[model samples]
Target: MSEANIDIQLLDDVMNKTVVSVEESKEKIFEIAENAHKENNFITLELETLRNEIDLVITQTDELEWKAKQARQRLANISRGFKRYSELEIREAYEMASQMQIQLSLSRDKEKHLRERRDELERRHRNILNTIEKSENLISQMGIVLNYLQGDLRKVGIALESAHHHQLLGIQIIQAQEEERKRVARDIHDGPAQSMANVALRSEIVEKMLNQNRIDEAKVELRLLKELTRASLVDVRKIIFDLRPMALDDLGLTPTLRKYLEEYEKRHHIETKLTLLSPERRLQSSIEVAVFRLIQESLNNTAKHANAKQVEVKLEFKPNKVLFMVADNGIGFEKQAKGERPQFGIMGMQERVKLLQGTMKIESKPGKGTILFFGIPLRIEENTKAGGSEK
Candidate 1:
């Protein structure tokens, strides 16, 4: 029993066991198919996500490109600023150089003018120094030649003075000679002429008497009056000849002086003396005239102012000089007071002497005889420049 039943149970148990195995196999196959389907859906979702991520990446790239363009514009602006700054620096430097050149030219012109002024001042200084030196040399040489020359000049002056003094003596003698001639003429006209007229009247009377009837008396008287009249006519002719003698001009000064003196003494009945010392042959005409004029003035003064009875005349001629004097024993005047006007004769004589570049001296005392002395130079024209010479 047990075997058959036990075999059967064992088979059954084997069948059930096979059945459970088939079920498990089916569940596994279904599970595998479902898992495969879920896997496929997940793969499709992942593909869609990848497409969206690609779009986001495109937007970010566009933003980065825009930033790069802005950076390029900023660089261009910086370059332009640097270029403008360089141009301004160059223009300012050029203007500064031009101003320096103008200042240098003005300084050169001032230097040239200063140099010319300095040269002119130096020339004037040298000329002034030369003039001062020449003046000093002339003043240093004036002291050595004074005394000997002065003595010689004084001697010459004295000789001239003496000649001037003596010059008038000739004129005085001439004047005295003329006075004698005048006295003679007067005596003849007044005394002898009237006597002859009386004699002529008596002769006419005698002739009338003879005609009437007294012949003898008439003849005697007539003869005597005729003889006297003839004699007087002859004397008158002789006086005419004596009035201007040729010897006065031709024979020289001394002869004329002697002739004049003799005539003066005879006529005036006064004492007059003459003294002559030097020979006189020839002299300058002006000098001769000066001597004569001096003599004439002296005699005139004596005659007019000095009531003298006696006059002495002296003429002396010496080497380089001539002197003459007229001295009268007459009452003299007092010496003139200061500032007194000159007397006419004295002034005339002084002027004559001065004209010949000479001097005159007069000496007199009150109640004493008056003396006039004149001196002159014989050759004044030859030695000095006096006005009397015609040349």
Candidate 2:
């Protein structure tokens, strides 16, 4: 085999081993969570039984106290009238009082023991619940890792092969892709996953409340759960829009940009204006997506690092090219080597424009706002001409 083939084979072997290791770990965690859940259920039932036993013991003790009081009174009366009562009567009365007192003491002790057991069980149940939650979260994270390895990360080999001449750029792209995946995973876990878990728990609570005939409380819980579901839906939709705005395909670029900027201004509390120098028209899908991303990234930078109060965007469509500009009145900094978090956005924007065979320019300085401009060549539609090409 050639050296490249050998290298590819080695990468495959390494990935397979890594995946196996992760899968094994995930299985172990799942097993642990299941066991913990079972243990919690058992503890719950035990606690219920213990509480009932304690209640019974309390009733018995209360009755014993009354009987012991009567026995004491009878013994005292017999003792006071020693000449009128037989010795057997007095002795019997005294014994009865002593026995009643002993029974009361024993009953009270039983109640105490049952209560302690109930408390212990409750503590164990809570700990088991926490364990189950942690184990479940770990399992979910491992699944994300497995998906990344088996799905998108697999593209690394193809990227390396295709960009052999640009190894560093390929690696940077891979890193960016990995970071994006991590971010998406984090957002899902924190937003939708947590909301769904709460929804499940709340639904269970509502069911229990209704079963117990707590109509008012169940209504309140149901309302809260509905709100949570709504919030989760909104979060899910926002994440989807971030990934790819469907409106870009349906309504074209101008409406999409206008809607996006208006929402952005509302969300970030920044002023934004959009001016179209030429009438809106559909470009190629690739160009549309690229341009949208460029604007999106610029606005994100402005929000995160620019501390901008107002931003303006301009778009101009010509016969053979499109022009775009974003100017922000924010705190800008001196440009230097790109190695920081703030610089990563700019770097990504530049790479995106480069992929579209476009030119991008950035002008910024300390105490000055930032302005970004782009000129992207438009490609003729294949259906429009037999030899359609980029202009």
Best by TM-score: 2
Candidate 2: tens digits of C-alpha lDDT, residues 1-391: 5887878778878888999999999999989987886676567656766776788898899999999999999988887888999888888988999999999999988888888888888889888978976887687668667766775455556666555455544444555555566557668868997788678667777897899999999999999998999999999998899889999999999999999999999999999999999777788887888889889989989999999999999999877788999999899888777664546677778777776678999899977899999999877652243224222
Q: Candidate 2: global Cα-lDDT?
A: 0.82
Cα RMSD, model 2:
9.7
Quantify all predictions' global Cα lDDT against the true fold.
0.57, 0.82
> Candidate 1 residues 1-391, lDDT tens each?
7786676567556555654554455455445534543443343333333343444444433443443344434444444565654655544444434443343344344334434443443344344334333322221211111121222322433345564444454344434434444445555755566556557556666876778988787787778788878877766765553444445457655666666667655655547788876555445555765676566557656767787788888988655677888888888888888899779668767766765667677778877988877777767453333333324
TM-score of each: 0.35, 0.55
The residue pairs in collision within model 2 are none
Report the poorest 10 consecutive residues by lDDT, candidate 1. Answer: 139-148
